[model samples]
Target: MAVASVTYLTRLAGYIALRNRTLSPRIVEVMEAAPGCVLISVIAPHFVSDRPADLAALAITLFAATRLPLLATVVIGVCAAGLP
Candidate 1:
């Protein structure tokens, strides 16, 4: 698949580019924390919005997320948001 190929190629490129390099402790720490930062950046705004529907859906999603798999949590969020 195209997605798989792109993912593999990008990883290979990164490996080739970083070959024989020693990363500093700070750089390694940043790399480890980057995904959490990115995830928060994506989700933070949704949590702070003034809309009731948005808040309700996010709350339901957060609750479901604690007890369910990711796919089910996402589905619950989608269905909750679609409620009339």
Candidate 2:
């Protein structure tokens, strides 16, 4: 098999293993990190000259309030982020 196919298979196996152990602390950490990173990225003046801190703050607040698992929020955020 090609290198890419091998890598994909390895990732798939890892995912299957991880899903079997849902709600792990490591996964929670990843879930919180993505929004914080996105919040920071959106706040950085260099990225947006206007510095929409208000919007970023609101988004982060809502994300925090959802109380959903990191994987769910991150997946939703990623999909929503992609749409626009």
lDDT of 2 by residue, 1-84 (tens): 464465556556656767766687887677546545644654354344354654554465457549878776667655544442
Compared with the true structure, model 1 gives a TM-score of: 0.57
Q: lDDT score of model 2? A: 0.57
**What is the Cα-based lDDT of residue 50 in candidate 2?**
50
**C-alpha lDDT values of all predictions:** 0.79, 0.57
Taking all chains together, each candidate's TM-score versus the true structure is: 0.57, 0.29
| lDDT of residue 33 for candidate 2 | 62
Top lDDT model:
1
Q: How many times do residue backbones clash in model 1?
A: 0
Per-residue lDDT over 1-84 for candidate 1, one digit per residue giving the tens place of the 0 to 100 score: 664566556556655777789988887676556555656666789989999988999899999999999899989988998886
Which run of 10 residues does model 2 get worst, by summed lDDT? 42-51
State the lDDT at 28 in candidate 2. Answer: 63
